[model samples]
Target: MLIDIFHDTVCPWCRIGKKHLFDALAQRQEQEVHIRWHPFLLDNTVPAEGYEFRSFMQNRKGIKAEEIQQIFDNAQRAGEAAGVKLDFDKIRLAVNTKLSHQLIALAPANVKNDVVEAIYQAYFEDGLNIGNFDVIVAIGTAYQMDASELKSQLNDRAVSDAVIAESTFARLNGINSVPFFVINDKVKVNGSHSVEVFLETLNRAALLDIPAKI
Candidate 1:
């Protein structure tokens, strides 16, 4: 099975969804599954340097403090239920995830999952600015990717453009939200579905004779 996950590193629900997907896969360990991470920027206009998390949500989304608090509360509950911890209070900045996505794209298949998980941990747990080059380099190196090569590729225009192009392709394909999952390119599961729901989708997709492409 080929699971094409379209998500941004900064999305809390994306982190939860990833956990659910992994859990579902774990249950079906006998089946072969390949995951391909794709880019989907939640706010493409966010500056590379990023903005204070509170100010960015309030100013850009025009969300009131009460509503934002409610959102955080709900996310916390959801994350807990999914065996993931989302420390919104620790997040200082809301950053552009273009560079983070580029790193994921550059990661080798064996370490790609680790790269993605590390990015999620850095942004949502550690509250690190994933948009920062040094922060991303640190995460890449920790995942065993060549730090110097990762840094060089991150600075290259072609790599950045490719990440942008992937985001554009996602938007063109009608993916308007994060945590979107495409199974074998034939079934689409949107949102942060539960583990059972994800498992059901995977089972259904497995029944099909579609060629898996990752």
Candidate 2:
């Protein structure tokens, strides 16, 4: 089964949703699946220096820090339950994820998951700046990827263009917010719902042969 996820780098809820999804997957041993990480920019045209991640959310999203904290609390709980660590205190920048998305899309099928997990953990837990080329190249290298090749590839127009195309495609699919999960290309779930909900929906989709949800 293929679960197509449209997500972003700076989204706390998206991080939590990913944790929930992975936890659901880990509990089951028999189901085989492929993870495809697609790009969805929270802000596509932000300035090069980017903006303070938390302040940007307060100003643009109009969500108070306290409300955001409550949300983060949920994420923290969800992440801990799932064995995922989220560095809420350390996250600071809202970077352009164009190149990160590009790296993910162009990566070989075998390494795409590594790319996705790297970005997610790096940005959300390790507090690395993924928008910068150097950090991305470094992450790509950690996966045993060629750093120079990745740097050259980032400058290529096709990958950035592809990121834009996928973002547009996501909007056209009626997806406004993310961690948007498209299961078997037929079932779609938005936001971080309970594991039971995911288990039920995924099993009913007939995408996995496993008789029960773990």
Candidate 3:
């Protein structure tokens, strides 16, 4: 089974969703499951010039800082339960995730989970500027990716354009919200559902023995 995940690194729910999926996968790694990541930029239309994270949240969602913090806390606790340590307080900027998404898009299918985890940690725990090339360069280096090669790919328009195009395609597929999952391009599990729900879905799919339908 191949899972297509439409998500953004800065999204708390996406991070939580990833953790749950990972936990479920860890329990069932002996099964056949492959994952591919796709970009679902939460605010794709936002100008390249980034805004303050809180201001953007307040303006768009009408969420006060307290509400955001409360939400973050809930997500953080969930993450811990799933064996992922998420640090929200250190996040200083919500730069456009276009570049980060591009990097993920370019990563090979086998190493994609690690690439996605790196992006999540870079944005949440490390508080690194994921939107910046320098930060991405460092992230690639840490992941044992050749920094210059990845950097060169960033400058190339093909990868970024493909990521942006996919982001739009996901929206057109009725994905108004993300952490949208497409298993085998047939099973569509949208948004953050329970780990039990995800585990059941995967197990049922596995029982199908060939292709899965959702």
Candidate 4:
């Protein structure tokens, strides 16, 4: 089975959705599943250097500091339930995800998922600036991607354009949110659904893939 996962590296809910999807897949170990990670930029206008995390979110949401804290508390609780850690306080910037997406696109299939997971960990857990070239390079290298080659590709104009194009494609396809999924090119699951929901969707898609009896 092939699952196309549209998500942003900096999205806490995307991480939770990922956990749910994997948890569902774990229940069906007999089937072979391939994941294709696609980019979805939550805020494309964030400058290359990025914005001050707290202020940016507050301004964008038009919420007071206390209200923002409440939002964080909600996200933290959701993350905990999904078995994903979200250290929102550690986040210093809300960065443009173009470079990070390009890095993921350049990765080999075998370790691509690993690269994705590491990027999420670096951003959401470690609060590292994933939009930074050096930080992305570090994540790439950890997954055995050639450092010099990775840097070169990241600097390539075409690579960056391709990442943007993919995000645009998602938007054109009516995917206006992160953590959206397409299963087996037939089942469409939106949002960060629960493990049970994912499992049911997976089973339904799998059944749909079966050949009809004569």
lDDT of each: 0.91, 0.79, 0.79, 0.90
Predicted candidate 1 versus true structure: per-residue lDDT over 1-214, tens digit per residue = 8999999999999999999999999999998888999999888788978999987788767889888889889999999999998999999999999999999999899999989999999988899999999999998899788878888999999999999999999999899998999999899999999999999999999888689875
Clashing pairs in 1: none
Better model by lDDT, 1 or 3? 1
Evaluated at residue 124, the lDDT of candidate 4 is 85
Mark the 10 consecutive residues where model 4 has the least summed lDDT: 205-214
Clashes of each: 0, 0, 0, 0
TM-scores for the candidates: 0.97, 0.88, 0.90, 0.96
Model 4, TM vs. native: 0.96
* Candidate 4 positional error at 189, Å: 0.8
Model 3 ranges off by over 4 Å: 46-49, 210-214
Write one digit per residue (lDDT tens) for candidate 4, span 77-172.
999999989999889989988889999899999999888889989988898888999999999999888999988999999999988899999999
Q: What tens digits encode model 2's per-residue C-alpha lDDT throughout 1-214?
A: 7788889866766777777787777766687876677788878887656778778767776899998787668777777876678877888887787778887877778888767888888888888788887888888888888877878888899878989998988898788998799877778899977777777877776645433221
RMSD of each: 1.0, 3.7, 2.4, 2.8
212 Cα displacement, candidate 3 (Å): 7.5
Off by over 4 Å in 4: 210-214
Candidate scoring better on TM-score of 1 and 4? 1
Which stretches in model 1 have alpha-carbon errors above 4 Å?
Answer: none
Model 3 clash tally, residue pairs: 0
lDDT of 2: 0.79
